[model samples]
Target: MQAQTNKTENNTNRATQINARDQRVVQTVGEAFVDDPRIVCRDVNVFYGEKHAIRDVSIDIARNQVIAMIGPSGCGKSTFLRCLNRMNDTIDGCKVTGTILLDGMDIHDKQLDVVPLRAQVGMVFQKPNPFPKSIYDNVAYGPKIHGLAPTRSDLERIVETS
Candidate 1:
């Protein structure tokens, strides 16, 4: 009985800690917009099947300014970031709603192709998974696949400059 009581107390303490942490996170992100933002996200929500992941999130990312999303585990920081570039589209039963604008253009517009949009807004994953290719091939793949470089010499120049 004593052991059970101790466990219950510990769980209560953890819950309290999590609540306080969430409050702090909300306060920190209260002012989510910036002047002259390069990217704008409004009323964004994400749902995975029946699980609601992100809720009514709105923010602005300013040009040349870096912003970090800080929150407790499972607080939807990654989900929110993935929504910016529509990376969540690949997931099964993952639904995202809201407007994400890049340079005043809607990224999710029907006329806008995803391939070019992905290239324009680059995403760096937390895990490093280098492609199984030569260093030059890895560096040149994006430009070659996207047809950004029209010739072999152009590819070489791009790789060198990068």
Candidate 2:
């Protein structure tokens, strides 16, 4: 009877341990995205050569929310925005470290292609920087590149409306 009692206690202890571990895993993931966030960054550091442009910045943007980051000029608002779409990749000496996650996926991972990433996250510049070409050319550029138009007439219609 004592042996049976010991076996039952062991099973109960094992079940308790498994439950604790499962709770911990769920808690850890929940902490990563607070308030139902869509984007989360932790310990995010960015540098330009030896100069640290952004340091240890952590922020979470919840779904269907608007966040405006306002500060003095050169406080890295545009720099951080550029980091989102990997626009800084084009710069000569810019470097970024740490991690940025979109839907809990690492965006800064080297394997991730920035092309489709930028396409998914659209960007409207500060001003309407029209293409050096005509209004028709400016509107047709994206449609043509993305193969949205089959013929020149289709491109012309898009240009007229856009």
Ten-residue stretch with the least lDDT total in model 1: 1-10
Stretches off by above 4 angstroms in model 1 are 1-26, 128-162
In model 1, pairs of residues that clash are none
Cα lDDT of model 1 by residue, 1-162, tens digit: 000000112222111111323332212313456679899877677898897666555667789866665555556666777778776775668999888899999988989887877767765656554454578877987787688899889999999999
Per-candidate Cα lDDT values, in order, are: 0.65, 0.59
C-alpha lDDT (0 to 100) for residue 41 of candidate 1: 76
Q: After superposition, how far is residue 127 of candidate 1 from its true place, in Å?
A: 3.1
